[model samples]
Target chain A: MENRNGCKLVDLPESTRRKDRFSFTLLVVIIVLIPVLVESKYYLIVLNIIGLNTIVVVGLNLLIGFAGQISLGHAAFFGLGSYFSGILTANYGFPHWPAMVVAMLATGAIAYLIGYPALKLRGHYLVMATLGFGIIINILMGELEQFTGGHDGLIGIPPLSVGGLTFDNDLKNFYLIWAFVFFCMLVARNLLDSRVGRALRAIHGSEVAANSLGVNTSSYKVKVFVLSAMFASVSGSLYAHYITFISPSTYDFYYSIQVVTMVIVGGMGSLWGSLFGAAILSFISEALHVAKQYHIIAYGVFLSLILIFLPEGVLVGIQHFYQSKKLQRLIAVKTPFLLWFNRF
Target chain B: MSNSDSILELVNVSINFGGLQAINRLSFQVESGQIFALIGPNGAGKTTAINMITGIYPPAEGEIYFEGQVLSGKKPYQVTRMGIARTFQNIQVFQNMTVRENVMVGLHTRSRSEFVRCLLHTPMVRKEERMIRRRCNEILEFMGLASKAGLLAAGLPYGDQKKVEIARTLATEPRLLLLDEPAAGLNLQETHEMSHTILMIRETGVTVLLVAHNMDLVMGISDTITVLNYGEKIADGSPAEIQNSDKVVAAYLGREPW
Candidate 1:
């Protein structure tokens, strides 16, 4: 009891805290009810895809958004996860769960190896280094014929299951993928509210300031990079298992760019923004699937508009707009004649 | 010999940036519990010396000893954990973070929990968070920023932002606090409050090393003053002695009494 009392954070009034709690519960309810509300098979597939992107973006948010590290090779880790898991489950006859775990571990190990040296490079140099890594991995995925089937890709990957339930269909797989998505979100939120999150954001703000506050900025950067890679790896494993097919082209440089776009569009430094970014971009991509030739151009236009109009993020933009509207309403009510003059 | 009473000593430290000397063979000692001031003009290298002492820059020559341990090759985080904390010259607050969280971050060194513990948010992590948060609250109240704890640090007014910076540093519970221009953009009343806060901090036995271009604040409260000009120490003495020094006048003062 005494320890609990000592641990009481948030000196806020009870009303504000309760309001926050209500909003959070409402958000959780909405996320849980997403599948129930949407029924089209295509939409279901797209939602699953968005969930996969969300898991990756949430981790990327921790790195690029909070820790201020850019990654242009996130797709490499994603591809690695898919390839590793696919080979283990399909060729080596390993269980789905253990294969996914191994893939995640492999991605984490490789990220640590590459991140230790690569993180020392800053700005465009770091971007170039990561881009090179992605291209190398993409090449290896295509050239490795014996294990990965080269350009033909490995096929007939098994579905993931737990105990007695198998996620064998799009709807079932939707549940599986979203389960992981929410779990990742929970983990991200926990990290964002803790000392580690603060240190990472401090590093983003100013590495010098973070170091002067006793944060090991270099090591933290590497750690977050590895963590984000593991997130990508898990998402990749989910992708390979769901699609039951994966070629090197599935995880290309363009995919990495899309991941970064999702982070930027959703808003940096926010979990909700990551989800929104993934959903909006995935919707846009799928909706324009009929006009495949113009998809890239349309994505370019969308990204440009988002960058130019709401660089802070779509969620933040909406919030700002709402707040201004509320302020306008308050002014109109307080001064009736002023509202008439402001009608123009 | 390294004096047991003095907490920090700089033995002829020097640094050069692209052939331009940023700090030149500067030697100074700060007593264990006194408000020591480092005063200089625009380009006098006071902040550079502080940066070197805090491990942001490695000295090209000489040595910095903190409580008898050499600071050479030590990282900034290492220096911080060794009981030194610093504020920045250009207000490097985490623009996106809240004020309370800013202060809580300073307690990163004091936490003993591993990543697993933090990620899991176990009882131990909770206790640590509570303790750190409570201390942050107390620091904010002391700095007159308790009401602004929930606001984004960048959203605060200039004077309050400076106070938030100091409050965050104080959360480290440093034996030696390095404040870089705590009153740079502050008005007169805020500066008065800041000096009072500095006195209270000294009363609590936390030694201070302040870098400021403002001489009035320096002379009013500083137990000792080191005047710098052209990256070199011009005078080191009591404020009155510094005020009377001819070299300090010709280089730093230029016949101005204020």
Candidate 2:
């Protein structure tokens, strides 16, 4: 329930802090226990991909849910990160860690340049801009042969390593990827709870109102765009290293659509919804393998269903469902007393 | 050219929408601590004038000076930082946010911590956030919406939503506040409450400039009234003076002989 008093921070419920703590604790327990319980490399790999996707979806949610801006080209940013990190480390012999950082910064810079102009004008300009940008980058990834290794794809991307240890197998990479996922979620949560977060939600709620209140809406929009892009870049780099291979197809339009679907299905504005979205969608896609050619259609159907029934996404939808069920029970209990009182 | 007490001065300001002029040669001075009203029939460019003042649309001619700084090219947020804040005629409160969060947005210009600091939850940012929470509470309490702080703004009644918008603007600690129709859809009681709120805001030393169609509200509280018609100012004086002025009376109702 909400605080209802002016004493606490606005909009944030009293249990939110406790709930977040509990969720984080639960996540840690799951992360630590999953590998031991599952014992299958295939499942671990799937879980790792979900973790990587979670990071990007969470970042995308900030732009989509908080700023009410959409990017159909995030897959391009994802590609850029993979190609940058993969090409730099595998081809140029750069260290893996620095390559990842460089990839993120470069992606952030690119997002800024794109966001600065696109964000100035209101409405669906961003959607069009990102759509065009994603296609161009995906083309460049294939067309550039020497650097990217062409359609043959970039190979031999080194798994991340510390001084003496390396994440080469599925289980090790699982820990590595999910570790990043956990950290990314924490960062996103922090941003959401702070002043910047509120400014972002305000921009989403109404850009005019946000501007009137001294929010540099354009700048903040661009900043969040860059931040989300950087998040995608990190996930992309992890994806490249874990898979030990990179290709333009991996960051194609469908992948972008998939993650966007995840954002909506999980809950547009909910952080944990991003996780559930990525997990559920990724699992569905994997499970739909028998329908190979029809999987995209299946995704379309699933997306339509979610939009129709759970427009707020799965997280908030479930919340409303739970709340209403509780309310119904309370009313049912109170009806008998009301009927008796009516006779008087 | 304005005296030291002039908080905002519009000088020969005009704007055009394509070939049509929305406001023409309009000039007014709101002195410090005055409750000024700009009243006119619909489509008289009252909102357009407010837009120009708040830097939503720059005047095509002349300048708007806030504390002697030219506001022609400054962005809306820049005008806010310069201590000029405004509310929309149609309420523009952040519907998804809580009433307190809406007010917290008012502190955007005042609070210094940004993305990195807020993400890290740095000592300085935490300190600033604490200060912001305290200030938001004070604002909500002052506006008597403290009990509704945690409620989503979209869920509040229309009158309370109006108060939430004003409370949010107050959080900006603005020197000059432009309220566009502060009492538009309100009942008599709500309008009375709004007038009291405006007077209270003025008592705190903030200059109030409102655009309203409600003659009772404009007459009841305004220290000065400026009447506009067809994008031109027809009369300017105290409420009583404007009420008695032939031009002001003609603008509201057509000539009796006609």
RMSD of each: 4.1, 3.7
Residue by residue across B65-138, what tens digits does model 2's lDDT show? 98888889888998899999999989998999999889999988889988988778789888888888888878
**lDDT agreement of model 2 with the native:** 0.91
> Which candidate leads the pack in DockQ?
2
- Assess each model's interface with DockQ, reporting 2 decimals per model: 0.46, 0.59
**Alpha-carbon runs more than 4 Å astray in model 2:** A1-14, A325-327, A330-344
Clashing pairs in 2: none
Model 1: residue A61 alpha-carbon error in angstroms: 1.5
- Candidate 1 lands at a TM-score of 0.92
**Backbone clash tally for model 2?**
0
Q: What is the lDDT, from 0 to 100, of the residue B16 in candidate 1?
A: 98
